[model samples]
Target: MYQIIVGIDEDEAHAKLCAEEVVGMPGDGSEKHVTLIHSFTDNPSGASATQLAPVREASDVLDEAGIDYDVTESSGDPAEAIIDAADDVDADLIVIGGRKRSPAGKALFGSVTQTVILNAGRPVMVTGVPEDA
Candidate 1:
């Protein structure tokens, strides 16, 4: 079974969606081990506190579905934290949320998802959220 690591961000809706996708992944008829990972920055003024909530919500769903998973929390740049977590668990897949960034923003500071997609040695999945979310 594939070991999946879903990258969770501060957005609840995006996280929930990613979690759902993880829960729905076909197990090749075998049970897959999933790891829900959320990264937070040291900046309390930021959305760090809410970053891991999605994993908690996702955990409830996994529990109800009888799927097995472990949740992890880390502090640092989101991309780095996610990569590190995946490595820690030897994950076969890394799922993350995708966002649209302004041209200037993308040029000045690369998006985390972009960096992860470019660098993660393992397979990665990117999911988008509803427009209202």
Candidate 2:
């Protein structure tokens, strides 16, 4: 079984898409190990419903797929957290969900997806917002 790290954020739809992609990857019908990671910049008393929504959605997909998985929450830069999680788990692949961004917006705020893609040190699969989404 392969170890995969899936980076999920506030977008539940995108998160589900990422999880679906992970579950659909070619395998020998054996359960794969997955680590679902959610990164936050601020220290909240606890995870708000909105913050937990994506995790729950992704977890549901994994559960239905019979995939072995765990959830991790980290406090720091999103990209750094994802990369760190992958490193900690020795993940074979990393899946990240992202949205369409304008060039100026990306340049102004930087992009976690881009940063992770550039520095993950492993294979990365990026899922984008669906056209109908």
Question: Which candidate comes out best when scored by lDDT?
Answer: 2
For residues 22-84, could you state the per-residue lDDT of candidate 1 as single tens digits? 777876313777777777766565653334567677777677677778777777788988888
Off by over 4 Å in 2: 48-51
Q: For candidate 2, which ten residues in a row score worst on lDDT?
A: 42-51
Candidate 2 lDDT over residue span 1-133, tens digit each: 7999999888889889999999899883255899998888875567743358889999899889888888888887989999999999899999998879999999999999999999999999998886577
CA RMSD for every model?
3.0, 2.0
TM-score of 2: 0.92
| All candidates: TM-score | 0.82, 0.92
Which regions of candidate 1 are displaced past 4 Å? 28-30, 43-52
Alpha-carbon shift of residue 57 in model 2 (angstroms): 0.3
